[model samples]
Target: MIEARRLHILRAVADHGTVTSAAAALYLTPSAVSQQLSALEQETGHRLVERSARGVRLTPAGEILLSHTHVVLAQLERAEAELAAYSSGASGTVTVTSFATGIGLVVAPALAVLADTAAGIRVRVRDAEGDASLPMVLDRQTDIAVAVEYRGAPGADDPRLTRVPLYAEPFDAVLPLAHPLAAAPRVPLSDLSGDTWIGPFPGNPCHDVVVLACEHAGFQPTLEHLSDDFRAVVALASAGVGVALVPRSALRGMDLTDVVVRPVDGIAPTRRVFAAVRCGAEEHPLIRPVLDALGKVAG
Candidate 1:
């Protein structure tokens, strides 16, 4: 029977155009290279190489064997990589970029839960606002990206990405302890005309949504502060810096001592959260668990 080792040596000889060159390249003595090729030829019952003026040339059979060897080597490498990834807690690390609320309220919590459950899973998180996260994900800087968009604000341009709608949460106007609106179960848009507003600054999805919602509410807001940090936004809302528009998911189980979230009246402001991955790698073994974990946490 022909051995894979012998086949590999023959392929090297075919590639290098001479047994001496192949032997040197493989760190094998010329004699060993010749012996392996000789054994391979004998096992196959065929003449695989012919002497040339300079060195040697592969016969038709040798050419075919060389081609098969490449296929076999590639298959073997893929198998090894797959097994290693599976054994090492899906060993490849997933670098994730997340929107503020998603990081604090969703991804961070899920990763903590996964650490306790999945031994082979590893995660790296980055604070990426919605606008920058998409390009980072498409450029492969981040393995997964969590972002926010209005129902149709993602635009019509579809790049090479796999988008999953994780969840959508209603937007609420957050009030401070002394605000008169704090006593109302939910504030209507008509009541927001004269109030100061807290918003994520420029280029933030929440900021954009806050702008659009206010326009729909018959008045543009007087922006008091622009904050991308959800913790800071919460602190501002708690300090009565200004009333902020917040996603329900951000407050779902969080404790806000001085802040109250009331549904905005007349306009049901909602932000759609999405998770994106590289198109081809969306099915990678490490990706499914993380996506499933998001679903679990979002639920």
Candidate 2:
């Protein structure tokens, strides 16, 4: 029932020993200070001060309230100091979830960046695919989600999320080194119509992209191998099990001795990467820098 601001006024009067002195200390008019003191007394239903021409003094009731006010004011000061630290993004923890490749490409590098720059921020990372991660952000399970664009995914205009585009990477064609077209600089999707495909499973965003791209190229792919790992996809292609379209980012730093990676000719099947947070949360001091760091690393 007691207001923090009025408690502050009460503490000031007790400190200054008079309404007029407290008013000067607070930059408030004497009447304004007096009115706030009256309201505080009424709110507590206790005669908090005794006034005389000499000045003002606390009644025993006032003395007790003043004692409590000291502790309350100290706590209020601490809360204000913490709020200012949080508002400036100087210290906090932020949780992030992303698919494996995204973690490697963006989140990992981002952490390194924040370490050197915003050392006060601690980030917790989770590995989750776009389908799983997007919903996590929507439901408040995480502070940020680095995800891929996929079927049934929320659109940019979705009121629940604020999407920040990180990058779009083409799905490079992976072929057996001995395959007939392996030597080509780039291969058209239609040219591989007869080949067995190695791809992510049905529900994956990459799977939808590959299937749609193949359909646009005028044939539905015959997928004979499935795995979410790009390394496995490349291994399968290298062993002559099937050909695949793996994201360029996922291919980073892997040995490709047995398989050849080529760009998809004309209209490549690409994965659009982004970071998402609950609507209006993108401005959070800790979260915003993480997003910016992710974008910087992805770029």
By lDDT, the best candidate is 2
Best by TM-score: 2
How well does candidate 1 match the true structure in TM-score terms?
0.62
For each candidate in turn, the TM-score is 0.62, 0.70
Q: 1-299, model 2: which lDDT tens digit per residue?
A: 99878877776677567888778767789999999989989999999999999889989998888777756655654565456556774688889999998888889999999999889999999999999888666445687999999988989986457799999988889999888998899899999999999999998999999999999999999998999988889888889888999998888898899999999899898899999987656666677789889988877
lDDT of each: 0.76, 0.85
- In candidate 1, the residue pairs with backbone N, CA or C atoms under 3 Å apart (3 or more residues apart, or in different chains) clash, namely 89-120
Across 1-299, the per-residue lDDT of candidate 1 in tens digits comes to 66868866776676568888878767789999888888888999989999787988999988787777756654543565466556753755778898767897779888977787675778999998877787566444687888888433344244345677788878888888888889898798667778887777877788878788888878989987877766677788899878888877767666689888788876588888888875545556677678778878877
How far does residue 288 in candidate 2 sit from its true spot (Å)? 1.2
Which residue pairs come into collision in candidate 2? none
